[model samples]
Target: QGVKVSGKTVTIGAATTHYDVSTDEKLRKACPALAHMASLIGDPAVRHRGTIGGSIANNDPAADYPAALLALGATIITNKREIAADKFFKGLFETALKEGEIITAVSFTAPAKAAYQKFRNPASRYAIVGVFVTKGKDGVRAAVTGAGEDGVFRSKEIEAALAKNFDAAALGGLKVPAKGLMSDIHASADYRANLIAVMAKRAVAAANA
Candidate 1:
């Protein structure tokens, strides 16, 4: 029904639906950015029907969950074993999941401050470029989705800047260069690179707010 956050970690069952994640009071308190991201996915109807695990297992390059999970340093538990988020995602619509292995749940250590910012594609409502940022025991981690040619990826430059100063101003001069980023009909690699920086700045602002 709802997600589970035990100790410093949060877990969402594979069957747990998106609407539940978006509305679960405990989950909201534990990780507001995750809940807020759930709320922003598609519309009410879509949110009602989508499952977090489904989105995660699909590993869509533009999907929201991958960015958040990666940035949060989450673990994906499956029928076989547990996989770290960093190792879970392989590429666009690809994952470390084997032929029969099923994702049971995803767990993450809740960050002290975290936020997600997305530039949506008008019709699809999918992220043209999305950024997820977190500051916690692991320090600051920044993950970018929808722009990477290889799927979701961590931005070391952004993380380094935010790790030093967790403020939007710290990232003002920094840039996510347009290399190895995807170029699609909706957005060019250069445009997505720019979006990455802007979204990172906005995400930092949102985390502070």
Candidate 2:
């Protein structure tokens, strides 16, 4: 329920709500992109009610946090052990958390630049395709949510493009293959695929802004 800033690291308590995350002045200054992403999540009620830990523990494929965490190289701290974002998320509604282990906190080092973008579903505000891009200590990472059948994942193509140019123009002609993406009533696989590229480009532009 608290946000703590320690030099280069920011640690958010598990019970912290989306509203808190979005509004924290320290967080907004240290990680504007993450705060911006929190600001855009759900409506007022949902944001007020949704805790960061609950959201990530559930690991919803359309969830916004996972993409941001993954791209940011966040660490998921639990009562038992710590898990890297790269290995924390397994698939839809899945995580590396062992039975009875509860998430205690999440922490990440602020990146040089980062941003998140999503094409939302009008009814639920869930991302039809969400992208979080970052240029940080680990280099470039672009993670996608709401599109993968296996759940949130990094877009290697987007990473390579951004690493090369670090601009929206870098994604020009880049095509996200529909093969592993979702095809539900909300959107077809191809549409979500395209949105991945579009949102990634938009996120990069936003980060640069």
Candidate 3:
């Protein structure tokens, strides 16, 4: 597993483990939100064994990487070609990888300000609701995970609000409709919708902090 940096763009080997991603000095500097998100995934054992590519390849609905990757506009590098994050995730436990396609690395230009926040399940530690927000060349992006029925997705409302004012308070009184969100024993669609807003606000706060 390796991480390479060229100017503001950073490329991380697909085999790199969550632990490595969480602690790599270069990655931490280049993508603090990603590193912090990695740090919050699973337990120590899982962090040491779970690879970033494997996680994204699995495309688990509750996985954290997709939120940060999507919000950061990361490129998924595969043996066949590169895929944009927006086009990568298909749905629950699905991705754009083809039969013979293999992921090699994931790359992104570090954003100016970003952070991720998740409300997690106590046992498995998967996100019940997660949000990652960034303000950079893309202006502002807010990606939500663990709530959408179609998996990770951008919140246009949150993005528009942040574009107007990139602050946690800017999201005040914001509401995310529960129509397309998931409902489980842990949380209802309405509950996750509330979490989406709460987590987005927290993520913006962390980015500013």
Candidate that would win on lDDT: 2
lDDT of 1 by residue, 1-209 (tens): 35877887788888877888989988899999999998989888889899989999999999999999999999999999999999999998999999999988888889999999999998878999999999998699999999999999999989989888999999989877898999989989999989999999999999999
- As for model 1, its CA RMSD to the true structure in angstroms is 0.9
lDDT of candidates 1 onward, in order: 0.92, 0.94, 0.93
Model 3 regions lying over 4 Å from their true place: none
Please provide the root mean square deviation of candidate 2 (C-alpha atoms, Å): 0.7
Of the candidates numbered 1 and 2, which has the greater TM-score value?
Answer: 2
Clashing pairs in 1: none
TM-score of the candidate numbered 1? 0.98
Model 1: CA > 4 A from native: none
Query: With candidate 2 superimposed using the best TM-score fit, by how many Å does residue 103's alpha carbon deviate from the native?
Result: 0.2
lDDT of 3: 0.93
TM-score of each: 0.98, 0.98, 0.98
Clashes of 1: 0
Model 3 TM-score relative to the real fold: 0.98
lDDT of 3 by residue, 108-161 (tens): 999999999999999999999999999888699899999999998999989988
The parts of candidate 2 lying over 4 Å away from their true place are none
Provide C-alpha RMSD values for all models, in order: 0.9, 0.7, 0.7
